[model samples]
Target: MQLVVKPVPDTASNQCLTESCAWHGFDTNPPFEDIVELHYTGYHEKKKFASSREDLGEPLRTEIGTGKVIKGWDEGIVSMFEGEIARLVIRDDFAYGAYGYPPMIPGGATLTYEIELLRIEKPTSNHKLKPSH
Candidate 1:
C-alpha cells in the first residue's frame, strides 16, 4: 500500500506539504481538536463504494484528533482551512488496514477520497463562571 498527495493548482499558494500529507485551499485554519463538517467520497480500485454526500443525510461531523475518523484523515486534515477541498490517497495502514472495513471495503485496499471542508467549529474557550448570588 502506498500514499501520495497531489496539490491542487489554484490552491498551491495555501498548500502545506509534509512527509505524509499535503493540504490546500484558503479559509480559517482548523486545529486538530476542532470539530469539522465535511463531504467525502470513498473509493477502492477506482470504483465508488460509499459517499457521505450520497449515503449520509448530513455532512460528516467529527472531531479531528480524537480518532473519530481514520488515521490518515487525522494526519492529513490538520491545519486545513474551512472550504478547502483536497484529494487524499491513503494506504491501508493509515486507513482500514489489511482487514479493511468489512463488505463495503475489501482487504488491503488503497482508498482515495475527495474531502471537502465545509465548516469548522473551534473548541470553545474555557472560562470560569462567576458565583451566583
Candidate 2:
C-alpha cells in the first residue's frame, strides 16, 4: 500500500580510499619491501603539483609499504603490477595532512596521482631499471 526509498550513498567516496582508490594492472603485484621504480605525476586540486618526468633520467624509486613515502602512495601503489598505469585518488589523511606541504599542497587537500609502475626489483634480484618512455 505504501512505498518508500532511501537515496544511496556514493560508495566510492574518499571515506574508503584504501579500497576505493582506482587501479589498473596487467601483471602480478609485487610484494612489500621490493624496490619499485615508477613514473608519476601528482596533482592538487586539478593542477599539476609535481612529476617524476621533471627530474629526468630518474624516476621515483621507493620500497612499497615502507614509510619513505606518504601513506597514500604506499597503500595505493601496492595493488599495482609492473608496467601498470593508474590514477590513485588519495585522501588528505593519507597525504600531507592538516599541516600540508608549504607553498604547495594545502591543508586537508585531496590529491590525485597518475602513476606508471615501471619495474619491481625483489631483494634477490640485482636487476636495474630502465628509463620510462
Among the numbered candidates, top lDDT falls to 2
How well is each residue in 1-133 modelled by candidate 2, as lDDT tens digits? 1222212124443352533223444667767777888888888989998888895556877777666678777766776778767677778888888988878899998888877888887765664433221
Native-vs-model 1 lDDT?
A: 0.67
The reply for model 1, stretches above 4 Å from the true place, is: 1-24, 124-133
TM-scores for candidates 1 onward, in order: 0.73, 0.74
- Cα shift from native, residue 72, model 2 (Å): 0.8
In order of listing, the candidates' clash counts read: 0, 0
lDDT of 1 at 13: 24
- Where model 2 places Cα greater than 4 Å from the true spot, the runs are 1-25, 124-133
lDDT of all predictions, in order shown? 0.67, 0.69
